[model samples]
Target chain A: SQQGEEDPQALSIQEGENATMNCSYKTSINNLQWYRQNSGRGLVHLILIRSNEREKHSGRLRVTLDTSKKSSSLLITASRAADTASYFCATGGQKLVFGQGTRLTINP
Target chain B: SAVISQKPSRDICQRGTSLTIQCQVDSQVTMMFWYRQQPGQSLTLIATANQGSEATYESGFVIDKFPISRPNLTFSTLTVSNMSPEDSSIYLCSVEINVRQYFGPGTRLTVL
Candidate 1:
């Protein structure tokens, strides 16, 4: 069974608009990580936040983790057409279990 | 973070045959993993490859169908045996150092 479940399975936004995706997990986790995958491609690690951390930022990406709610969100600010891809959230244990993912399309 | 690489980015194989996918990491990593992503599905962990030890297979996955080899800390291979049309999927290799993981470009296999 998958530990993480992401909401709004798909999204469409204009270039330079912000896109937000949410994920919820069922169990406790030491860390939560986000990844991006192009169509029929491998995953690229985006960011990871520890259980103790509430928020993290990397360039145009901002991730917030609320362990109390067992949820996390990834926000892409000032999105670009290049940012169009599938985004997944993975909860880590012995292995990482990924969510179904959110497909984001950036209209130019 | 690590730079991971996989060979034979994509291939088409006949049913009942087998294909071996290789993964190499620039730096030694304690834990490596193989994952399968069927078309239109999320990634699923197949096994955890540990250097100098037997690989740990996940539920719904077995060693007979997906044999793995982690000869060293920096290298590993996953062989999809007795390939079937159902085996067509993307196989990815990942290395974990501490809490961070880096993935190799996947091997896209199509079993005809």
Candidate 2:
């Protein structure tokens, strides 16, 4: 069974707009990480938020973790056409369990 | 961050045949893992490949079907045996460094 579940399976927005994706998990995790996958390519690590930490930021990416709620969210600020991709949230433990990704399309 | 690479980015194979995919990391990593992503689905762990040890298979996965080899810290290989149409998926290899896992460009396999 999958540990993480992401909502709003797909989203579309214009360049410069902000995009957000949410994920919920079933088990306790040491950390939660977000990844981006371009079409036909592998996953690229985005940001990681530890259980003890509530928020993290990296360039245009912002991630928030709520261990109490067993949920996490990824927010991409000032989205670009190049930002079009599938985003996944994974719960980290002895092994990382991935969620069904959310596909984001940023139109120019 | 680790730069991981996989060979034969994509391939088409016939049923009953096998295909071997190779993963090489730019730096040595202690834990390497293989995952399968069926079309329109999330990634599913196939096994954990550790250097100098037999690979650990996940539920519903067995060595005879998906054999893995981790001869050293920098490299590993996964072989899909007796391929079937249902075996078509993207196979990815990832290496764990600290708490983050980096993935290689996946091998897209099509079993006919």
Candidate 3:
């Protein structure tokens, strides 16, 4: 079964704007991770937030987890054209389960 | 972080034929995973391969269709059997290191 579902399947924004993508999962997880894929290539791990932690920050990326709602959101500040790619959210369980993903486009 | 490599980055095969994709990791790992990403879609895990054991497949997937082999901690392979056009997709292999998962470049398979 699919564990995560991301909304706003696609988003297009200006380079300096902030992009926010939300993900919701069904089951309890030890941690939730964010990944980025460019041009259908390999995935790059971004950040991971444990169930015990509500929020995490890495560079210009910010992740927030709400365990009660079984949801999480990733915020990329001052996005660049290079940030254009597919963003995926994965829930850690017996195995990693990926979300549908958000296709983000940054207009320069 | 683990540096992983996959063989035959892309291949074109006809229906009824099979293509075996190989994955090799720089560091020894206990578990390796195979995932499929259909055209314009998110990734779906095909199976989890553990060294010296049979692969555990997820629902909607079976060993017959996607046979996997994990001979050692650093190497694994997945073969797509009896291919069809629907089987065209990117197959990726990944391993977890320091609890964080890293992926290979992936094998792009196109079945005609």
Best by DockQ: 1
True contacts kept of each: 0.72, 0.64, 0.64
Q: How far is candidate 1 from the true structure (C-alpha RMSD, Å)?
A: 1.0
Clashing pairs in 2: none
Top of the candidates by lDDT: 3
Worst 10-residue lDDT window for candidate 1 chain A reads A91-100
CAPRI rating of model 2: medium
lDDT score at residue A46, model 2, on the 0-100 scale: 92
lDDT string, candidate 3, B1-112, tens digits: 8899999899999999999999999999999999999999989999999999999999999999999999999999999999999999999999988778999999999999
- Misplaced by over 4 Å in model 2 are none
Ranked by DockQ, the better of candidates 1 and 2 is: 1
**Model 2 chain B weakest 10-residue run by lDDT:** B94-103
lDDT of model 2, residue B44: 89
lDDT of 1 at A2: 88
Residue B62, model 2, lDDT: 99
lDDT of 2 by residue, A24-59 (tens): 999888888999999957999998888999999999
